[model samples]
Target: MKKIHLVWSFFCVMYVSLAIAAHAEEKIIQGKEEIEKSICELNIKGQIEKEFHLYVTDGYQEMADGEMIYFWGFTHAKDFADVEEIKTKAERNAKLLPLKVPGDEIRLTSGRNYVVVLHNAGWYETEEHSGINHVAHTIHFHGLDLIPALDGVPNLPYPSVFPGEIYRYLLTIPEDIEGTYMGHCHVDSTNHIMSGMYFPIIIEKKPNEIYGYTFDREYTLFMSELDSEYMETLREVGDIRRGLDWNSNYFMLNGRIFMDNLTHPLSTINDPKTRIVAYDGETVLVRLLALGYEHIFAWHPHGFHGLVIGTDGRKFPFAYEKDTLLIGSGERYDILYKIPDFSSKRKCLSCNYGPGISIAHDHNMKGMVSGGIYPHGPMTIFDIRPKKMTP
Candidate 1:
């Protein structure tokens, strides 16, 4: 009788343990499913470790009137916490987002990560009849066009005061495809932008898919512009005005030129005179976001049209092949292509798009022109090679 009682107790304990384990697994699975949905949200917050400055140029200098502008352009961080690890006030910020979704009330622990959903992650909307809204609403700035457009917005009565404060949204990432994604303010402000305000965020994919290629390897590059002339115009206008829209003349990938230049000596070319990443593989996905006013991005791989796998954050069933990807303003394209099989004119694989596939650039015929004396600004390239050969 005693032995039977002990055996029964042991079985009951085992059963309870299994039930708890099963419940935990279910919660994790649910988290992953919620994450896979199209719109991803991240609860982002930060602390200004010190008196941090927002710059518009790559180089750092004070304007003649004495405003600190980063040399070349603005200086924002790739990650929020790199400046200072702080808690996230996502719910507080979410109130400002236009497209609110159905979900539980969530609070983000400052340093810890959390998940949310974006009903309209990349969509832009104007504020109400408020002064800020009227100016931001009067014009729609995309990619590099802000430098010129912001000129028309109401300016500060004093030079020492900024025209208006820029506002941004906060979100969280579900656990499925957690990694780095890029975002920027979608308004026009050339000098303000080049000063340094763009940044990147991480989405923690659900545990099961945390490491695998459940989807595909992908990245997003935001292209924008800044203008000294436009900044001065805004300073002069002192109030919002119509008919101020100008095509984006400057361009940048991430924040700098996309070419392979250590120091961006040339300012006329939008050609990002720097390189971002090394891309050599069987399948590569490049997400392109055009934030300028009215330029079509003719993104062509040097030797390939790059397969079109997705658009505006939505995946497509069939791939569209083309030499130049004509992306309109406020558009996003997900491109995929394989590494070159053979060489072109030179011994090594080149970055040109005619026959051999090696490079990527904008096909906005006019955008290829230099900004004033400088070349286009945001042009970038991904060097794709086999993983085995990567140094």
Candidate 2:
């Protein structure tokens, strides 16, 4: 009877502890709130078709290991809904965002004139950039057809924008060119880009429809890596004076990594910007952007194959199918993935497994490893569901 009582008490204690821990975890929400809209509003307070007020600065992204990695980024400063809201220069400083790594994804319509007011507010030392540096920064529109003047390269004629300086980049997107693109810091391209000063630049024929193709859903798998040791050196010295040794360890998909990335709100399971969700027979367009300094990102899906329709923002005349895709730095690939519908039983021999997940991850060992852990980096998922199962 005494032994029975002790066992009962032990079970009760275990149950109570688990309950307490559950309650504690319930209060902690993973991932940040969707600060920027999935696709930002266009024609925001400008006479042109689209105009962006961007603020440049620094911020910190807390990695899966709880390490706060410092990054340089751009954030939407002003989306002046009303003309009355447009005030002095100080007003633009109100919505400065420096905490995000990839910056805001700029979506533009084809055959529309757009302008970007690039304001260099310097490092992320403080929310308000009181102390500025001489280091210049510029936006190099990778894979986008642009003139040398707007190229964002540091040269004698068109110098990169420095601290406390603002430069306006104007471009008219041609109807012929509309697809995946990228924008990054061109000044000290090696150091600046690797340090996390980049974002996806996608020009669409419309919203979800990319000219010849239409997608039920879309996701941007922006692939990049972090070298903690190299970053640490830059963090301490304020710059990479010794040149890039090129030792990246942590690989990420849309700024999140590993098992934590799979469950975290900032992941494919949650982040609106990179969630791979599709119903039976639905098509999901995945824009693969490799922005890292080194390596070829070899990615593949577990259950199904993807149709490679475009590369580097240009649609190919013929769409080819591939189970695995290899993309290099500064490169982009647009692949269309069609979910096998459960209703179409003849087509889905694999659907016998039923509605489940298909892990889309980098096959490259470097992409899958970090700090001696297998399957620890650059992973996302494709949540496929039956017609009845989907909400």
Candidate 3:
């Protein structure tokens, strides 16, 4: 009886030791998975830390009609090796350095944190708007459910970012909300938004998690209009409220007229870049957004139709194919464009041949013109090239 008791005690102790060791191993594996997931969430270059400094300044953009339009815009604050380098560079070309094109697009992944440092660089006078200079600006992210303090609304949540003042915005892209959203200035929206303080915000889902579909390439189109009259009125009156009667003279795709859209590469011309390049037999995803306050754009692709898979960041129950889509103001559409084989002899609805450059333009003929110039507004090309061989 004494021998049996000794063996039972020894077996019980060994079982408890083994159980504790297994639990510890499980915890270590869990910790490793958590670390790997965090690394995977980093930016494309694997840099875990990223910061974007957006400097708001006033400038001029030459329109396709040879008219220089006065504009209030944002430029990325270029990084310098040190403070002395920045000061030295500023002294030489202070005028030319801040006067860049539209702001860069803010790309985020779901379940990640981002810090957007907004700096209101001092105002500048333009020849077109000689009397008026740029003023306080705020970033209002459309369709984001943010706290009131970070909403970027003047007088309601937080005051406008004053000139020479810096404001840091802490934002988290929620896992549930993933898609294309718009960001613009909420201060005097009518004037500021039309003045080009806007860009697209794309929140992507997890790597293995598919959102109803998949694609090989992605492109974004921010359909907007330029109300030159309204801008001029604001310049003269210094109040956006007084410029209520608005008339848009220039239609744009990603802040460029039709000609720039055809010439410039993807993401080089403007914020919410518009150009698209894909290989034959590849699936391309197009994120379409209309920023106009009143205009509804009828988006049409010439060569092939697109499969309408999602709208306003939500997947559709049934996907439908259409050649033209009527997108209303503040609306978003996710279109999947599947390229056919290059050798296939497919004919488009308008009797165009396939596997070539397709003219994607607004079906609203009026939106295809810039100051009465036909075929010179909001048109871009979808170039489908033959697949290249791997080295």
Candidate 4:
């Protein structure tokens, strides 16, 4: 049919001229503190001037206040903006995750007032286009005191730019020992993380022989996704609004989302809604956070086999066996499983053995689904108790 409509009209005008040449004329750089260390950069120059294709955002099932809230982020601009054909790649790159959100939300407080005038840090008297090898800092952040009006908004900082764009910084890995580290934004001049920036960096591991063991009760979390139309077009041009634009599709752990299972009704131990069971070694300590893309948050302690001491946040020199544990994306692991006992007719301490299996997913395979929406996305679960059991 006329050569398939002339090759689909020359592939939709070479895909809108390579999505306007990978977001035309782009240049970014956030902060790179140095009095002891700090870094975040983005300088994608731009020049696809022809072809593109990028997609990867699969998360979202919102409700906001009426509850039911599940979100995720990162689409790297839909993986690159649907490339059809045109040719030309002088440059087109990406790097993100420099987070510092907490201005009492109003969509990240008008995207941090357009990010303090598109990022403006201090101490740059001028090094002639201060272009590479470093030079730009202006960090702050003081939220999270149980969120009382973001309690004295000051400590949260990272607005140090110079032809910069694409950031999210908050680093402090003073060699917390234990290996595996990654903090993006070295910029190449295009596709700046599909234009939502980026995030994922964690450090917490130090103290001999792999990660000795010591715990009482722990829980750490991190998983991402967002593509609400490219984070609402970068919060409307870098104003940076955030309520939900996730694109992680499946980056899971800790109850991944809405329901992997949560149903324990039918009480009878005096019926107050029972739930508490776990005996036969009884030792619990789990901490696994895998922020920003890249998967592998697997930990299935069905009958028990977990002992891994640490991974991304360091700690592991004497406690390794695995029933399956492989976390990534700014990693962090500190498992120590030992809770599997039921027999005596699945032992129901009066009626407290409804749900207690142990499973934490995200074995990659396209995460779990959100943009594909099957039971939300991600994954999570953990419930085992036996202090002599009561109710």
Candidate 5:
């Protein structure tokens, strides 16, 4: 394992300063529209095309232990014509959404042209020798078949998208392609994606419909693993090569570790967009996407089994039922969970224990802990609250 001291040494001082500075930061978690605006990176969606303005910037996520793990991610660019104007917590919080590790959710429709504009705004942390200041980034649409021109492999065309510049991608997704997919940085992908440059992408057959099934609502769980020391090395010297010392010690679902998920403002359970909430007799669609250096996540829901509907943006001809779903690096699964009518004891067999609170955790033994601490890795919930209750 990477020396723990090096990790915290970089974080300890930053946390003290960033924590105080972020106190007055503006948070967009109030109104419904504002919340959606914060979580979704898609800027515009037309009938024939969807447009996105993604800003490549550096940010930090405070781990369960209060250590801020430095990462590079994609956030929404409020203005299509701006670059690297903000650096402080207050400035970033006011002007841009703090970058999430798995970036942001982008919903797509089958057979539509997608226009993605990526602006390399720049990094925030000014650690000398981090090599972050001179780096170029690109977004490779994973699990999607696109031409070499539209595909985002670096140097395939030229020097790549550097800071203060923007790259435009005109994507055409086939009509029959609709399922769970992802977009991530391809240049030094091992370092960038592990440092938090990926995001969830869902291509639907149509709105709220997939593979001839409809659901009341949907949630996405972006699973990832991070080694604070590994990130420290990246931010210290921008090492793109994989090292034998690499040890991913923090496992996450939607950016935050477990236990923290129960309370963190940006966690899976607290984030209304990601928390699996459903009324009785309704179907809930869950898009599970994962990435890690060497981790396999066995997703285990406590009470009910989910119907495995799709994978890697392809619909399954025959759906299967699985309670503990296994996910590997770069894999995406679309699962449909039909919440039975819990008002009646005989409504559906095996759902007798649901409708209140059900814990969904990573059964991959190692994923249950962060930095070797038990019960602190990826864990979330499926809640069916009182119909009138509000967050």
Candidate 6:
């Protein structure tokens, strides 16, 4: 009877040990599962939000002919400590926040939320405007698939943003969309766009995703034209509704003529924007955007052919190589330009063959001139240096 009791006790102890071991294993698995769930929640909450403040106001843009043209456009609004401090800050940073033509570049990453608050400041008479220049404006992303309410078309889904009014544009760049896009005024698009109310928006691919090809440098080339007659009408009439011929007197890249672009690679004298800087044996990605209302630009590189890799926010199935590409109004092209090694025959006049300069300009002969001035229109220089030289 004692031996039987001992065996039963031993079995009870074994059962208790096994039960405790099983419970401990279950608890460990549950803890691991909880940790994994928490990690996922953290990843979901990690999406970033980008915000910007843009003010739409009437301003003056200097033309290549040394004339200040009256125009309606956007500018970056600087942050102040309070509403009362804005005037003092503006006075302090007057040179820092001068009126910018071509607006500001809207750069956003894929898979993020962008909130741009547009404030319509009442038009102030400048030397160019004198007594004219009054118009409502709204921002319209040319190729983005956004909700109708957020679209900046006036009187279609919402009214145009008037003076002293504000509108917030909420946008979410999809993870799949990555390339160059354009934004401009949808209200009185023909006149407003011609009167300098457009900008470029670039969406970059995420880090983890492979964009197929990597580039050493990138440049944004915004090709646009100006009609002086239409601008004059806007200054005289103060009404954008006045119909005028869409004749382009000035062709520009980033608001500067060819000579000015060569001197100031990026933005015009009024604002600094984009410039092309590269070295030999290096690759560059050029974001080509044509913002003209009617003209089509045939962009040609002098020394080398560019590999057309993408268009309108999507990569091509295969790269297409061409020396000249025709880009119409509201079109974007992603061209990969590979800088060639310098040859004695192709050396530039300025660099003694050490750093070669090649001209990239519009293929259309008319586009090469601004206001009847030769070599003063839509053109820029590609400064290619030896691999050892700094760019």
What is every candidate's alpha-carbon RMSD to the true fold? 19.5, 22.3, 16.8, 20.4, 14.6, 19.0
In TM-score terms, candidate 2 sits at: 0.78
Query: What is the number of residue pairs that collide in model 6?
Result: 2
Window of ten residues with lowest summed lDDT in model 4 = 102-111
Give candidate 1's TM-score: 0.48
lDDT leader:
5
TM-score for each candidate, following the candidate numbering: 0.48, 0.78, 0.75, 0.30, 0.79, 0.77
Best by TM-score: 5
Please identify which of the two predictions, 1 or 6, would achieve the higher lDDT against the true structure.
6
What is the C-alpha lDDT profile of model 5 across 79-158, one tens digit per residue? 43344444554666677777767787787887777678777777767477666777889988999887665578875542
lDDT of 6 by residue, 142-214 (tens): 8898866567887555567776676667677888888889888888788878878888988887532225778
Model 1, global lDDT: 0.38
**Per-residue lDDT of 166 in model 3:** 66
lDDT for model 5, please. Answer: 0.76
Model with the higher TM-score, candidate 1 or 5: 5
| Candidate 3 pairs with clashing backbones | none
Residue pair clashes in candidate 6: 266-274, 267-273
Worst 10 residues of 1 by lDDT: 97-106
Decide which is better by TM-score, 2 or 3: 2
Full candidate order by TM-score, most accurate first = 5, 2, 6, 3, 1, 4
| lDDT (Cα, tens digit) per residue for candidate 4, span 2-41 | 9999999999999988876544422111122331122112
lDDT of each: 0.38, 0.71, 0.69, 0.35, 0.76, 0.71
Error of 4 at 50 (Å): 36
> What is the lDDT ranking, best to worst?
5, 2, 6, 3, 1, 4
Q: Which one wins by TM-score: 4 or 5?
A: 5
Q: Give the TM-score of candidate 3.
A: 0.75
Per-residue lDDT over 1-391 for candidate 3, one digit per residue giving the tens place of the 0 to 100 score: 9999999999999999999878866764565355445545554545544555676766667775567777777666345111111122243245334443345567778776776667776555444454445478888878788866568887553458776676666676777778778778888787777787887777788532236578887888878887877776565656656546777888888777765433343222332346577777888889898887677799998887899988887778889999999998778898988888872334344525254566688899889887777777887767667777312
